[model samples]
Target chain A: MTTRTTPCAGSEAAETEVILDLDDISLSFGGVQALESISFDIRRHEIRAIIGPNGAGKSSMLNVINGFYHPQKGTITYEGVVVKAMKPYHAATRGIARTFQNIALFKGMSTLDNIMTGRVNHMHAGLLAQALYIGKNRREEIRNREFVETIIDFLEIQAIRNTPVGRLPYGLQKRVELGRALAAEPKLLLLDEPMAGMNLEEKQDMSRFMLDINEQYGTTIALIEHDMAVVMELSSRIVVLDYGRKLADGKPDEIRHNKDVIEAYLGVAN
Target chain B: MFYREAGDFKTTYKADQAIFPIALDRWFVVTVVLVFLVVVPLLASNYMLESILTPVLILSIAAIGLNILTGYAGQLSLGTGGFMATGAYMAYKISTAFPGLNIVFVLIAAGLCAALVGIAFGVPSLRIKGFYLAVTTLAAQFFLLWLFTRVPWFVNNSISGVPTAPPRKVFGFLVSSADSDPIDRYLFVFIITVVLALVAKNLARSRIGRMWMAIRDMDIAAEIIGIRPLTSKLTAFAISSFYCGIAGALWSFAYINTVEPTAFDINRSFEILFMVIIGGLGSILGSFLGAAFIFLFPILLNVMPGWFGLEISVTLVTQVELMVFGGMMIFFLIVEPHGLARLWSIGKEKLRLWPFPH
Candidate 1:
């Protein structure tokens, strides 16, 4: 039962509806088992964190969620629908969006343009309109621009909106990357090490932004973070991954005390 | 006073969505197009029109086609000449075999034929990227040229391996052919180039265009966003090849009056690439600038000899041209990597913000 595990903030009645279901998910590249028969359910609107040392398959889990790498075996059920292997764009259109551990914003484009690209799905003005810059196409463009402007403002990137992301500070680039994901209005937001390289101030700002996004937009968040403190502070439920296997899945407090989780953290494999 | 978007009011999405959202920018383009189409014909001599304008117009079209694949789509191609040749040869075959077919219809068909080939070659892009991908496109260039030269039917078994364009007329007036005036030829090419350029611009701003840029920017992210890489890439190839085909057809029918397989040689491919490179990579206007720069610079270089009445050797001119071209490429890459388009945009921005760069 999820009662003893998968810590959540909402009422018991609403928490049981699954957002993501991993059934005996097994994946490998050549001889290495990147993930092995991992099974779990991510309930709707929960801030879930998958944590482990380097090479614990945290990123692999994120990749598998969006069908970047088809697993060697197992089925992934998202929103009560089973997905054998769906394209990334299909996952995106289905309201799933993710950020990379390494920043992946369009390097040559200004931050505003980079995020605006996320709204391409919503803009339907055909090539003629875009080229001719006539009538309905122009209107759609402005509307998209205004929407992106609001997102830029919301992300507090107004000062650097016109600056190419390649020139931005590392923290700002990460925020812009987050802004890009937010532009898609995803129902499930995946963050890979959102606070990997930030100092205290950046960590605080990003943490606040993550919490605000969850509270205001009611977006579901799943993240992988190496910083135990960040995991402890932000995650309601912590899924511990060790050598591609699930060592523990429980409330943050329970995970802190579990011996198997302790052994994994202490670098003593069991 | 300088680069401001102040008073660019927008009541509807369309008002704000224009490619040139600022009224001033739109007016500038209209004014330039007017000068190029209406005014130039009235003032320019036949010699300038034929020798200068004709080639520039044709190169502009070729540059735009390759820009779609290389610039906007983020795929580098070295096989533009091959696709263009496909168009030329196809046009030749269609014109000769299907005698009495309007040349206009023949031209469109030729471009479509080239587009099919472009899509075939573009498929390899799904697997490779950057320099490696560029080399693969060469296979398309060489293979296509070989097919045309060795295949007797392509040239209608002509001994020259070059097909001669029959003097074609429109309503009893020769628009462009061996006997047509360069002025008449320039006008026809200019008109068609403008229309196709508009289409290219439209395409770059559409969903397909955005998909290409997304693929260029980040393939992993683009795939995740529900865009099929194959579709985007192939579309870019299709569009690019169509333009190249049109340009190729124009080269034979209007400008050259004859084209051998070597006409669409590897040098032709590099020339088109240089046009894109010197022109801003993703900027449509860059194509014109690049074409003008590549085409006009040689003439300007040759000017020194002409003014002094010095009969400079073609070898000397060719050598000097290479040096200047190489230097220009390196200078542009180091100074402004975005190409000529960025330079013009920066100039416009400066003009917009002039005297008030606060």
Candidate 2:
């Protein structure tokens, strides 16, 4: 067990409020417990990292947050609202967006369209308006396209905007996925290994973009990353999980020295 | 070189988002439309207009509809034939009940009626998916045909259970009924199909289209991105059925003159599905191409043996046509699952980069 340390007094992180909190969430599939009694908090305008070994329920936690899986016993408080049961659509509409561990992009569609889909909640034109491509529908489409274009520009993926995402390289696909999550302009962006398959250059680029996203848009990010150095560099606070149980939750430096976390990563001596 | 877009710069998102972004492509479309609307009508024979062109155009509309549902939205529906029956019956009922109504309004009303039925059938998609959902829609196909056949009200209490569309005129030009000219019917069907196809294209490129594709590509991800499965699936169903409905109405009223419930049976459903598949699942142009190929291929098969100076029996030609059709379908599916539209686009892509191997 590692002692949880509070944010240092008079710091910007301490001044921010908690945007999302999970109260003892437990998830299971049949008899196998994927996540058990896990609790964490993500503060506004901060990058919170959840780091653990393989099958430590990191992706499961993201799935629960996005309402893809329902925990048998838990309460989720997002932006001051306590939700008993959240649907994925409801979470998305309430400003929660996420990228998958494996790329879950619309492969048949172009990169621009894939990102534009993130603006689905913002578009409200009726079928008739859409069919005719007049007035409100046309205007709404152009507006969303412009917003998506800005994201493409920001992600430096303008060259592949018209290319189908399935044909894109792995690193670019990950970037497009992040761009899609960003297109929603989410309050809390959940990234599941945003730099999982990237090379050193791509990983550096992704880290910089994540930092810029945190600084520029002030988006509260909760990411599950395995690279200890990048995780330590990017996150303000870290949550260590071992076998679905929280081992430590504190600043990155504290987590690096936590006995339980070290054992969970390298194993205990015989 | 003509297909190049090098100098054509789009300054606005609106320009970039235009259906044909390239100036030359826009002009090519305009030229094709002009030739079809003006030149073909003036030069085409009665047999060409009635037997080949009009039916192809009408079926193209249905293909576009199915493409929207199954191709774009990734909802497998075997209810197209039934929805078409609903449209045919509804058009018959509306035009007869309200003789003073415009022919256009009658077709539109029939489509709306089918849309309502489509929404009802689309409910199962939320709970079930893939082949299971397809089975539910297959039930809709049988039930709708059964409803139209068993209920006398659909056929206006006619003993034969077949309804003939009363002669109707658009802009004082007779376009429906047995006595109407083939050119008028072809032009009418052509105009309606062009409009509907354009609308389908627009919907495909817009937010709704993207929503459908997202759901098709990944429903769980789409849901997390704020798309409600119920709304997206149902909308695809409603719109797809609407196009099929109008196609059905045109099939009975404008082309066939009178249609029985048997006209839109399970075979017709399969036929339309084939058109969507062969045309391209998620492409408006693929729907048109598939429709053209399916409708015209048999006629071509029958004539080709004669043109080659071979004296072939009618029965032999028919048998060979069937085998060839089946073989071609398999060949296309295996060779290019995306259908003719993808091939067409690939050809265009190659043309754009001609004289250089990229």
Candidate 3:
């Protein structure tokens, strides 16, 4: 894979610092190659969309980025540190947070509690202090809770704050999942099909949330999305993958006109 | 109407995050504590204190411990009796060795000892879950009991393998010896149980509690979002065992005044598990409710035949008790899997919407 760090022509490259760089990352499950020699860089404060058809290894790419799946080959550089392999805890502590392809909210916990779990790394009180629920523990809880309330406001899930996520509808659960990921105050957010199974109205709401998250928080996002229209509208840049291989990489319009991407993913017109 | 939360506005997160956020709940808890402290001691007979309330409180602690692991952390364990034995034996050793140590310090030290053992047993939980982890803990149960029973050192070289509680005093009042006043023992166990239950409630609402629940709900997602499964699972085991240990210590020192390894056998573990399940898995109140029901129901069964003027034999009563307990377990599992605590909460919810139907 060639170095493709230069932003496509006609796009702003002022914030050119690469927050995460996947260098020749290859992963497989026995005989099947899930992601082969995929090199990509997620820039700071950019909505980097990973677009692919079925079996294109989009989720696999996100999994590798978040340290859920360690590649058999290559290194992942995050914040300029070349990490050969990362534990999910290490990835999360280093400001990498993600939402899953299927909504993975804690089903037994209240929405507020689910979001509060995102701040586990930030909590430092000892067992005794927490057991007593006084002084430092109480103070830390209130402080983190205040921060979480802001995310609750952003996601507009205040009505269901105390409702268990399992009881919520799909769109609301997805929103709660987003709220949970956002609560981590991540430097890079990996979203796997953030709008999957949502109606058009929910899709628009999620798209607005993605744009607002990118613009307001200045968080770098790498998303695996199947909705072409949503991807075109939300992503600053797009990477096309086909059969565990990179097909094309460029701005949304550039990928839209890429012949190979059209033939492989969009399909050819008669 | 009595359970209504109307006009109870919280202006701060601290108030909002309170264990009893509702003003009515706070008042209700305060009233219950007052009754236990001031009224129950003054009114209850020696038999009532020793056989019923005291055992309920002690077993409630063990139930809470099991609840933290199975109910909240989602790690099924059958090591409650074994961990309790560890605590009971540890307390015996600590008090006997120290001779002049306060009972509070002894209890805490015993609980710590049990927590360490719990952590060791908890290590297997990292690789195994559900019934498999339960089976591993079942091994802990048998091994711990066998170690205590076979090793004369645990009973301090007693021929009968029974360790007796030496006389211990708290605030100049005898609390541990068999000759101690029943009221003093009841109060001692009651105070400790109340404080420990509050602590358990606090832990359940804190970040650690959230971590346990996260692991319980979906461990993969929990790890991805950065909850260390090892620490969470171990802490659950440690805290649970600590509670069980304290309960065991009190059982030997205060409630029974003498304990054999048989006191904390497989039957005891199953009893506590029953309490946790029937009370509520993830609720602190459920632990107490479960303990009360399991302990009192047997006594009630024994006396119930007399009240009805029936000529039921003792063996028949025992058989009926076993059958009824089994039937109730199935009934609760199917009707209200969350246990009696969930039922209590549902009642409160209904109270909030009284005089109206939605």
User: Cα lDDT for residue A124, model 2?
Assistant: 90
Q: Which residue ranges in model 1 land beyond 4 Å of their true spot?
A: A1-14, A123-150, A266-270, B1-12, B97-102, B169-173, B308-315, B352-358
Order by DockQ, highest first = 3, 2, 1
Q: Write the per-residue lDDT of candidate 1 for residues A122-161, one digit (tens) a residue.
A: 7777555666766667677677788888888778888998
Worst 10 residues of 1 chain A by lDDT: A1-10
Per-residue CA lDDT of model 2 for B109-181, tens digit only, reads 9999999999999999999999999999999999999999898988889988786889999999999999999
Pairs that collide, model 3? none
Model 3 scores what on Cα lDDT? 0.91
Clashes in candidate 2: how many?
0
Native RMSD of candidate 3 (Å): 3.5
Q: Summarize candidate 3's per-residue lDDT along B61-91 as a digit string, tens digits.
A: 9999999999999999999999999999999
TM-scores of chain B, in order: 0.95, 0.98, 0.98
Model 2: docking quality category: high
User: Tens digit of lDDT per residue, candidate 2, span A1-270?
Assistant: 112243221125634998998999999999999989988888888889999999999999998998889999889898888876789999898899999998999999999999999999898988788888998999999988888888888889989999999999999999999999899999999999998978999998898788778776878889899998889877888998878899899888898888888888988856
Q: What global local distance difference test value does model 2 have?
A: 0.91
In terms of DockQ, which candidate is strongest? 3
